[model samples]
Target chain A: MKMLINVPESVVPDALRGMAAAHPELAVDPDSRLVVRGDAPVAGKVALVSGGGSGHEPLHGGFVGRGMLDAACPGEIFTSPVPDQMARAAAAVDSGEGVLFVVKNYTGDVLNFDMAAELAEDEGLRVAKVLVQDDVAVTDSTFTAGRRGTGATLFVEKIAGALAEEGAPLERVEAVARQVSEASRSFGAALSPCTTPAKGSPTFDLPAGELELGIGIHGEPGRERRPMMTSGEIADFAVDAVLEDLRPDAPVLALVNGMGATPLIELYGFCAEVHRVLAERRVPVARTLVGNYVTSLDMAGASVTLCQADEELLRLWDAPVATPGLRWGL
Target chain B: MKMLINVPESVVPDALRGMAAAHPELAVDPDSRLVVRGDAPVAGKVALVSGGGSGHEPLHGGFVGRGMLDAACPGEIFTSPVPDQMARAAAAVDSGEGVLFVVKNYTGDVLNFDMAAELAEDEGLRVAKVLVQDDVAVTDSTFTAGRRGTGATLFVEKIAGALAEEGAPLERVEAVARQVSEASRSFGAALSPCTTPAKGSPTFDLPAGELELGIGIHGEPGRERRPMMTSGEIADFAVDAVLEDLRPDAPVLALVNGMGATPLIELYGFCAEVHRVLAERRVPVARTLVGNYVTSLDMAGASVTLCQADEELLRLWDAPVATPGLRWGL
Candidate 1:
């Protein structure tokens, strides 16, 4: 598979070990498949936990720190973590205030987090779950029932985590997470397919001169394939798809995210077009983050996520955050 | 080219435009092709300026901010910025203390920055130049004389910029820059070749299951190509290449950088092996950064840089940095 891994079997644990080595501030438990804030379980503070697959790096795991996710349970690549992992993460991070699980709206993530929430509740910990279904690409997909959560997961985690860091109640944190989720939409376009370590081949067939629109992070069947388009054209289509679904009345915090292998130079070029399209539609951008935050492993593509932001959400977003995936204003 | 760019001709300017839009904190001059700190000409602070080809992103431009670079001049892809751009950037950021030109050791960059220094001197500005040539991959490469500059540009900019931020004179900044450069060594290995937009094809043919070692950032001929190796095996070779030259006794600040297209998951896995190798060799790491900081556009590979860190260098490295590419303690 031409990947820089020892083997397909140990990819997840090896990466977790790497994460542990790089960021000693985080308590990385390779055995539990958990990444938790070093000083998690802050007394009486709401704890935020999220996870899904391993490939979308810096998403759930990279977001764990001072003002983002309290803990993350990463699964094997493109697979969901079991309920045991999530339950253990909840137990590790939950304080008297309770735990808020930020579940992406994939079927496996939803089901597993739901079971974990019950497990946490059974253990006498207050648990609340918020599902992020911001991907407007599909209502049902290869591994999802409703909309597949994508970029807005970042928005939800950052804003909600900000509130939680302020010692907000678990219910408030969950509500804020839901608010951000409902207020955001994402669309992705892939120029190449991602090849998982286990699979060792591209999950899908995307010819060199063609591209897929509305593609899922895991290379799931997208809206359609077409001849490759220019950056501006891709921006036009992706932003239109998001804007049509978002129809925002307020300004947005724009995320022009790279899907794994897309370079920053290209991300910047694509982000300029995204800004141009948003400007043409008279949508005010409250803030913008451009990088590989939510990514598919080594997929050459980009995704645009827009979250309608109010003053409170903007304040929450601008709040200090220190995490491997996203960090700012700290 | 199946790139997220409008056209090869406009890629640099468009990406600059994107940089401006995304980071309002930086004064990005698209026409002049300069990215300067938003608050440039900071009284008597030594102005740090660096730039080279546009492909290695977040290198010079993305490092412009409060604690790193004062200005950067991005050239066309894999091409050095003209003397005029560097001269103008010096004019924009110099506040009488002096200007320090941070030049990579590529032939074009060294020549252009040398000319730029002369121009700045003629404009009644004192300018000192520091050339980074810390790559141990080859004594000389296709575009370089002596050692090729690679990951240590980041170290030179950062440690030197931290000193510059404290209003150090040009000479001291230049001295520290040279120190960091001399103390650091880097080695890169590539799984796949990078394709420039203008080329629209892989720069070189790297057959499947084969990889190139000691590759220049522009896919210049490396030491050799061999059958693919595991991340640990690659780390063993790359770290040996670096440590053989550096032989650091003090704790080192390690930068495990991705060559554009390598995913974070792999980078982390690779990082774990880097730490293991360093530990085995009894080399202590003062700090570590893992990501695509200095990149060759969309190359599926990575580079390892180790800078022998003394107290002063570690303090400077720990100093606040708020650039787009690297940020902490701000």
Candidate 2:
């Protein structure tokens, strides 16, 4: 559980300073703990904002940029950002065209962002929300509220950001974001448990030669724990679950994302296996991506996401997207 | 070093099968260890091919698609794919126009890819090469042969792939690829070493509370090892080095790439820091990206790359790209 830092309390503040220092285009509000692009109100464009816990690097924060989110509020490590921070971000990026909040389907994230949206509304701003619930790992909603948003969050950010950049109305952007969430499904398997910074211990007991399949992004236990299997077998289990949830004979965007510690080689192997599995089923893959898009903190595992895409969805997917987390087309 | 696998030797083969299955549109030649899109060798278009060791996922392999490379050869984990594999890939995707090889500046990668190019030429195929030596971490040619290509490879892949996809002449594509490689630069910092599957142990020792700055992609020792610093400092070191090398005043593309184990939250913070740093220098950053693009096994570290983009480069970056690793535009 060793980490590199002068003090645990300064991790967030010091990190923000450095972030602002490195990305001049991004404006960092130390007091509010928000990072935003220098041009607060993007002129006549609709603004997109997203934020969540801090453990998942590049998720809500890295996605703040042109063709994506206008700002991001990063909470302390593994903790949700307060409503005030989100409020500040909303105020900073809101344009007359309105603002969209891209929230992950987490209790803390949803509640906090909801409160912030209300606060912004009180301040005479228009805000809409798109909740991302793409993770198919958990079926029990009683304890967790809903399925966790994992790799599919990226699809929402990329597409919604693109839509917003193209000056789509808030309603259209929110609808498209929701569509991405619906069309996309994700599942993860972790080989090792992550040790939270505050807890300073393993989140759960995963024996030396075992894996937890269908795990949550927050390091929670999964649907099953079995003897470690081959990458091919793991791919079969993960991909089949996602494909089963999504209908057959549809074009889909595939993502083989690393949980955290898995090597690119391992992830590539996983993607390779996923490709083979889909080919056998005669699935039409419209697009494919393999990388660490959404990640756990040094957790040795990976996730697979399949987003069904039609011509319009594909066009939106291909549209220019510029974010700190996902950037393309310059 | 506890990996989830039925057998170490079967990792690559099983992964390949899964990839071919999942991305049926992307063709995989098991015999040659080559992966190409189903619609490769487009009529009257020059073919672009690239590859190297397997650890840096999505580099030469994940980039094979419509707007990027036509084919990719996956070598053994962290080892350059042999010349025969490269030859096979060249043959599979080469049209009557010609082929361009985008090679990272690793000695093994350069040697292997160069040999493959010679073999392809001997087979009566016109071939050109663009060697990437953008990493500024190592003294250009002091400790090693030259700076190791790390994150900048992505820019080369995207821009070069775009040119090839647009049916640009082989000479034009080769020139564009070379321009990208020269204009881009990268540097990395690591908290821990990545373990090679064959080795079964970390390649280097990173003391519990220390970090290695300016490390190469192959787990090579970095320029400096200091007590672990905050994420901001890490970002500063990497961003400062890249900006110093590029001195870009016009809009540029910024990439904050995780080596492997670092999470997205940290990368996001790092991106924010990078944005701040560039702004201070009055550099106009056109776009930003934060993720795990070029990685080193499961190393806990990150690298940053900066690419100067002009109109032509931007067009290529925006063009449709489809591959198992990166897919965009229809």
Against the native chain B, each candidate's TM-score is 0.99, 0.96
Q: Write the per-residue lDDT of candidate 2 for residues B1-330, one digit (tens) a residue.
A: 677444677666655665665556788765568888788778888888888777776566667777877888888777788898888888888888998888877777788888998999999999999988888888653224887877878898888877777778989988999988998999888888888778889888888878899998888877899988876677677888887788875688888787777765456556666776777778777766656778887787788888988877877776776655565553
Which digits, one per residue and each the tens of the lDDT, describe model 1 over residues A133-229? 9888888999999899999999999999999999888778888899999999999999999999998999998887999999999989889899989
lDDT of 1: 0.93
How many angstroms is residue B244 displaced in model 2 relative to the true structure, after the best TM-score fit? 9.9
Clash-forming residue pairs, model 1: none
TM-scores across all candidates? Answer: 0.99, 0.80
Off by over 4 Å in 1: none
Over B1-330, each residue of candidate 1 has an lDDT whose tens digit, in order, gives: 489889899999999999999999899988889999999989979999999998998788999998899999999999999999999999999999999999999999999999999999999999999989988989888899999999999999999999999988888999999999999999999999999999889999999989999998999989999999999999999999998898998999999999999999999999999999999999999889999988999899999999999999999998989998888765
Best by DockQ: 1
True contacts kept of each: 0.78, 0.45
Q: Chain A alone, TM-score for each of the models?
A: 0.99, 0.95
lDDT string for model 2 (A167-230, tens) is 8888898899899889899989999888776776778899977889999877887889998887
Candidate 1 scores a C-alpha RMSD against the true structure in Å of 0.9
